[model samples]
Target chain A: MTVSIKLARTVKDLLQMAQTEYFDAGHRTCQGCESAMVLRWVAKAAGPNTIVIGATGCMYVANTTYYTTAWALPWIHTQLSGTGSAVVGTAAALKALMEKGKLPNEKINVIGICGDLGCADAGGLSEVSNALTHTKYNFLILMYDNESSANTDIQETTMTPYGALTTFSQVVSR
Target chain B: MEVVGTGTDAVAYALMLADIDVTSAYPIRPYGGVMQTVARLIADGYLKAEYIVAAHEHDQFEIVKHASAVGARTFVGSSGVGWLLAIEAIVAISTDRYPVVALIGNRALDDPPGAYGVEHNDALMVRDVGWLLVWVDTAQEALDTTLIAYRVAEDPRVMLPVGISMDGAFLTHSEHVFKIPPKSKVQKFLPPYDLGNRKLHPSNVISVAPQVNEDWVTEIRKQMDEAMKNARKVIEEAYRDFAKIFGRDYGNPFVEPYMVEDADVVMVGMGTVSKPIKEAVRRLRAKGERVGFLRIRWFRPFPTDDIIRYLSGVKVVAVVDRDYSFGSPFDGGAVFTEIRSALYEAEHRPLMMNFIGGLGGREITYNDAINMFNMALDAARKGRVEQRVIWYGVRE
Candidate 1:
């Protein structure tokens, strides 16, 4: 039930971890994209029985592009401002339908991943707040603050206040 | 059972009858009424559902969209700018192909200091998007169509979302007597909501609607087009079965032609404008004038066959648009452009003209309808429309 939270402390434990590659290769991310690393570790930790909600950001635009996907697990894309709401709805639906004998009752990890621009600067803060208020729902929303709106040419975002400093620096250098 | 309630209340009853498993709400006038009633219904033990109150319309719509994907019958709605605010989720809902039923309390999407009144422009924005858009003129139709919307949208053939637009004050706020079918009869009429193999459950190991490039975009959009095309027949079936089980059939399933059988001129429009126009039709008929009214029900499907069938014999067609499309071809309204385009292929075409009025919920009086009809009749006799588009009630 708590597969995602299942910790691996020993080298033997890490080696014995599920060999299943949920987050497979062939993504279009830049070298040393730490967000991709987080997605990989989380996808592996959540295991196969997980529904990943990737908010519009670096991880989404990089992987799962046009008839292609690097993830073996079931994944769905959420609007930039819908990471929290999507996960809440998915988890709530799983519980409701399963209880109604519509879907099979089983423990499934619902993971929602969002970037800084999508979750914070793009008015998704309210969505995340509303999502957290639903205490009975079983889900997790991971807000990865990359400090800028990296998906759209790395524009300035809520996490990138120093983005204006770039302009100031340019002016001073001139 | 028959009960008197507002248009929004009628839709609330449909949510209960559909046995929606999840719904989301954020307070905006007109549309906010139904959520209040739905919450009351749940609190009073009349219905069982997950009622999520989000901080804004984005989360509100997103909640229901995703819920429908995971095999839950979901409901959500908004009005005016609230609907506009949820535009991102709204488009995603259609592309994701979840049969989520939404009640749009149609209002003007004006600037910051906007008025709360009936306007079709808010709903017209989705004309290009992949949503099954329909307009309900009465509270009774609102209730029944909301039920039918869920059925049509959830059908395997038409796995798309539906936007049921109700004219703000005239429909959403006005009270009218409507029949609420019992759960047993509704169960007979409508099947259970099922996504089958596409259900986003652990058991159904399928990913959906992932980001795609130019290589994959056309086919995905084409799939929606095919589904929308299939919806015509599926809608007819839903209406037939609804008549059999519920005994209330909206014949034609697209356009409601009132006294068009022997009329020389037909005034066309959607939503509550039909009320005043039908009254004008009767008044004109009494005066020995051959005039009729056609209420367009399904806007997304465009009801081309119904429009061509209903208006072909008529000499002239006058379209009263409650919403306008500035800088559009001939400066006509959205509905006007659609019908004109639909009529372009007809063997027998009527001299068509657009009359834009009733903007910002200004009342479309029967008198206004009378004036428009007279102008149309004059055009039919002249064999040409004197004016292509007229802002009917403008102070000019």
Candidate 2:
């Protein structure tokens, strides 16, 4: 869930050392958006041969705009209830092709990205748990707990703190 | 290849023969029989596969969908409320075109005053999900159709999941003689499930089910319909190959028409209800009545063309439905509404009568089928319709 950052000697050396970057730079995420940064690292680590399944949240809306996509690797944006199951399907299809010798036996990772509401409140956890416990294929589910449903204009959600003031929750001054 | 077994065992044997690699299941009445048989088969090493009992029916659907997505042939089952529970996944897998075979033990939905019995509502709930649905009448048909379902679903042209539905208690629990094809022949008939170039592989990373803009969303949706339309041909080809390999022909493989060529009144239905109706048609024909029956096989990608072609010559068409919609504008059965609309443009349309019966597992005997035929005959002779629907088998 957490990765440590290593300081490189210089930006030129860092760019030279990095051979592949999976997340494109032209996304429209809000300023200081940690979700987009985390996504960049995730896609970078997952490499080019990875399939990313994104749930309906800030990542989906911000990354996949009307005419453009910020995904350099193969990525799919699904509804809140679909990310987990869709990832499993992609992994299953990969396994089928690999076993049938239609596709080479290279290591392909299936990664699912969902928000706090998507994973914890939108009835999608069961789907993730089912895929994890049931399938032999390895799939990683990254729950971006942003403390609120941000795409809906930072509305208060189950993941929001008890006394947070937002569009759906307010403090009445005495 | 002939052996005495229940419908559950027939499906299990077919799953084994088809070489399913994973079976995700949760126990629900009538449908659980297939799970038990499959569990035992996997346990005894007869079927080499991963058999996982999921926490819930929804999980079961997702688990098998994942398994099928990963390139494993998969089998799953549900009945009644379990089907409702997994409806989201049901629609998801179909729209995504995952080729998983679901064995639906048709049972009444949990309406008020709930009871256990066979009803088509459970399977019919997601009728618009774009999956192919095959209604099997006998235990033998259950076995045969399961094999056919795999072929139909896996065809690259029609890569949608298929539902092989059988009436609970009537078919799942009842025993009948079923023929299992030889392993070699089945292998030949059903090649190993191949995704061809349409799979998730690291060698060629591809995105699926991606977000499409409004400009392209309609085309994505339209592709599902086109695939369903493509299924009509794939279904026929698979059934033809099935008949060739097994030597058991099911007439049209979409709709099985009986005694309709020279008949004036024709009855229509699917599943176990058709068995008794077939008998009723035989007896009515013997009694000098020009009567026939059409046992519909594929409900979705509904054999609309075959239904129209076969019923064109008939004078009266009785569509018997075991399920009803609470507030349909047609004020009749679900299938009856479809049948009525399908006949709107026909040059020679037959009089249509809707009979709602057999809800909550009530016995739909041969007498009831005969009664339906007589009603159709009366409507045909009178040349006009009165009551639109008869809730048969209900006591006043």
Candidate 3:
């Protein structure tokens, strides 16, 4: 599941990437929020032949709601810690179907989007580790490490670094 | 082909006949045998699919859910805590409308002190959810019901997941001879699963199960409600085609009745407990007593129409529940509670009582069935039910 990290090897790739907006406009994110911007680019870079499984996080909440979505590509929601499990499932399904002649044998990008609380902390790592063991499956797990739990109104998560200010930690002593 | 196999083997054969494209599995007793058999089939060239050995149950269930979303026929199974461990994914699969077929080797939910025997509670946990639930009495029924399950679940009228519950030890471990219809017959009965515009594919470009606020939630749930309602008809249609294709039909798709036509008292239940009750029905008939058995196959649609038609005329309907729900209204089992609710719409309104037994997999014998019949018959003769529920075999 390695895509060229450098999308702009030439002026044509950059111009081509700029011309297509796979991640559409009209999201609910705060005007200054960088997480949504990252999501937009991720969805765009993954392109139209991709299925994006957005884990429950600030990015997922701010970018997409029922009937309205910033993603022009096919998207599904997964649980916060479910990004790993979902990516494997989606990738495995694509491979299985393509091999079985149920679906066209095309290289579809399978990307799972998650946040810090979903990926590094909680049981997300175990799920990711399990998913990573399936080396044959083609998928990418894109982890967005936001310092606090944005979905629950900025509650302090295990990913919260030392002396970080959050709704849960107004007076940070350590 | 005719062969003797356990309940798990029956489901494995169905998976092969269905030609499932993806299966994710984890090792949990009773239910584990099917996945093992599937792996062997994959190795021996009997079946070819992505056989993933998942890290745990959550991954196991989730993998199949996503696979089914992309229009791949899928299968998965677990028992006891293994099923519960994947509860989060279980709820999502039905709500997301993925027709992923699963098997539940009905085991007593954990802390059984190493007792991994049969109980209905494991599957009953999802009774209120949108999943279609069915209990099979034998390996033959297990094989047939599984194929029917796929047909019903994948039907455009009812695109919901189906859980085929087979009693642990009694069915999962024991072997029985059953017919395995050729792939051609199965193909005639079950069409290839298609999601059309609803599938999550690049060609079909649709977002599924997005985050929603209060506004759109109710309508989405109402859709599921209608789908569940549609399942009753779809299930009936599937069984009708099943009989036509295979030349074997269990008269009613909802409930299997044995000697209940002219019975005064009918003992009702599900799963392997029906075996003992059926034996008791024969013995009671020999003694000139009008006692019979009604084995409920489908538990989710609750079989209200069948309940009204069958038990409404009987003098007493004694429900032999192998699982219990403590602190419930009347302290009855899940089946007892549901049947009581269904009978409320009945015209005759037969007297009903619940017999809570076989909890934690204690065997309910033919003698126990006779004891239940005697008590129910007594209540019928007196035209009153003194106790709403009785713990039939408990020491206390």
Q: Against the true structure, what is every candidate's RMSD?
A: 2.3, 3.3, 1.7
Rank all candidate structures by their TM-score, best first, as comma-separated numbers: 3, 1, 2
Stretches of candidate 1 above 4 Å error? A1-4, A7-15, A30-32, A161-174
For model 2, the stretches where C-alpha displacement exceeds 4 angstroms are A1-19, A48-51, A65-68, A72-79, A82-108, A129-137, A170-174
Cα lDDT tens digits, model 1, A17-48, are: 65657787868888887888888888878876
lDDT of 3 by residue, B1-396 (tens): 899999899989999999999999899877888998899889999898888888889888888888888888999999988899999989999999899999999888878455688888888898877999999999999999999999999999899999999999999999999999999999999999998898998887777887887998799899999999999999999899999999998889999989998899999999999888999999989999999889999998779999888888799999988898888888898889989999999898999989998877789998999999999999989999999899987896
Clashing pairs in 1: A66-B212, A66-B213
lDDT of 2 by residue, A1-174 (tens): 222233447887578437556777758987888999898877766666677778888788778765677877766655575556656655665665566564578667778899987877777877776667645665788899989888888887788988887788766768
Tens digits of lDDT, candidate 1, B1-396: 899999999999988888889998999877889999999999997888888888899899999988988889999999998999899899999998999999899898867446798888888888888999999988889989988999999999999999999999998889999899999989997899989888876666666777777787898899999999999999999999999999997888998999999888998999999988998999899999999989999998779988888888689999999998999987999999999888887888888989999988899898888899999999988899888999987895
Q: Please give each candidate's TM-score.
A: 0.94, 0.90, 0.97
What's the distance in Å from true for residue A42, model 1?
Answer: 2.0
Instruction: Indicate the worst ten consecutive residues by lDDT in candidate 1 chain B.
Output: B201-210
DockQ of 2: 0.36
DockQ, all models: 0.72, 0.36, 0.76
The sequence of per-residue lDDT tens digits that candidate 2 reaches over residues B123-148 is 88888878788889888888888988
TM-score of 3: 0.97
Per-residue C-alpha lDDT of model 3 across residues A1-174, encoded as one tens digit per residue:
664343677999999888888777857888867787877787667777888888888878877877788888888888767888888888888988888888889888888888988887667787888999998888999888888888888888888999888999869466
